[model samples]
Target: ESTGRPLVILDLALTRDVDETVRALPGVVHLDLPGVRDAVPDAEVRQVDAARAIIDAEADDFERTLAGRSMDSLITALRSHIGRVVMEEIERLRPLQSRLPASAVPSVDGRADARVVAGGGVIRANGSSGAIAVSVAAPETTSEAAAKVSSEAADEPVITLAQAERALHHLAARLLHQPTVMARRAGQEGREDAYRQALELVLGPDSVGGTHD
Candidate 1:
């Protein structure tokens, strides 16, 4: 009574074992052998169906989560690949900056930083450190740039950057499509080990985010 929990009594004896007054008590349930036996099958069927539904839902959620993680890891690896390519290309261009035609190079006050403005953003490559920095334009700046682009000729650097970004994005999607498909198939087939092994072989052992559960 203090705990406010219901009390359940199962009387299996052939004769009356519990006092008749017990059934009248608050929060008390008294079940005789015949009553208990008769309710078992229907109660069990209901419970089993509920349990199966929950398990199926959980399994579907787990598969989706796993597939999302696989895609995320692949995207991370792709970004790293793009960064490496950018760094290498920037380094290669460092020596040829002076020899490059004036029409090819964007005007800058200093040779130490090369900046490209495209699609309402700026990408800067540091000549000395070989580091890259990217920044998105503010809303006002983007609007002004858009107005300027409409009124005047679009900058060559902007066009080039947009083209490069589009090409890279397309290539990355194509490159990663197969791996993503394989990951989904592996998760559905319960062959997660094969997914990890194939990714390790392709992206290297250190590339696949973290250990699996």
Candidate 2:
């Protein structure tokens, strides 16, 4: 996508003094690039690099205080939040999975090895707004894996579990953005029945995405 530039992203999570945790984050964030960015090659990359330099300078602001909360509570909250995030995401994506062929999403090894995470993380899940802190434990290595995934995806699109889950969350936020719009004025029973049937098409048994199916 970048004519071969490896890009890195930063996500910021913070905790405040009070009930800020109860409010759910709204939809995605979008960045608009001027027409010149497309007209002039690499304009987007230049701008992004400058923006990243400013963020790197303020890295300390991204740190959080874990004072008062017990390690157990923090871990528990993390597990709970991650679980719900994944579960809701699966529900959201079941429909998409049903429509797309398995070949449409190749595994990491290029042989359907399912463990490969998505090749890109540009569109990612922002951690729960209410959570105190977000932590990740991973090997101190990524280059080898990144190179492999990138090479494979260049030939055919490859998807990872994390990528799939993130896509679901992204889709759910867009689909459910307007709850009021879901209200219908037609024959209520018939319309509602039709809606449920449509839902079943994507999520019902024997759906294409289901492993067993």
Q: Give the top-scoring candidate (lDDT).
A: 1
Full-model lDDT for every candidate? 0.59, 0.39
TM-score of each: 0.38, 0.22
Against the true structure, candidate 2 has what lDDT? 0.39
Predicted candidate 1, C-alpha RMSD: 13.5
Angstrom error of the Cα, residue 128, model 1: value is 40
**Model 2 residue 137 lDDT score:** 34
Please give the RMSD of candidate 2 to the true structure.
31.3
Note each model's CA RMSD in angstroms. 13.5, 31.3
- Candidate 1 per-residue lDDT, tens place, 1-213, comes to 267888899888988799889999999899997776678898797998999999999998987777556555544654566556656654543443333334433444433344544344445555567455766766334445445344333332222433334444565676667766766666656667777777778767665656454
Residue range 1-213, candidate 2, lDDT tens digits: 334443322223232322333233233222223323455658778988999998986663333121212122322333344456669756654543444345444555533223233222222222333111222334323453355444555544344565556555564565543321332211222243343344336445222112220
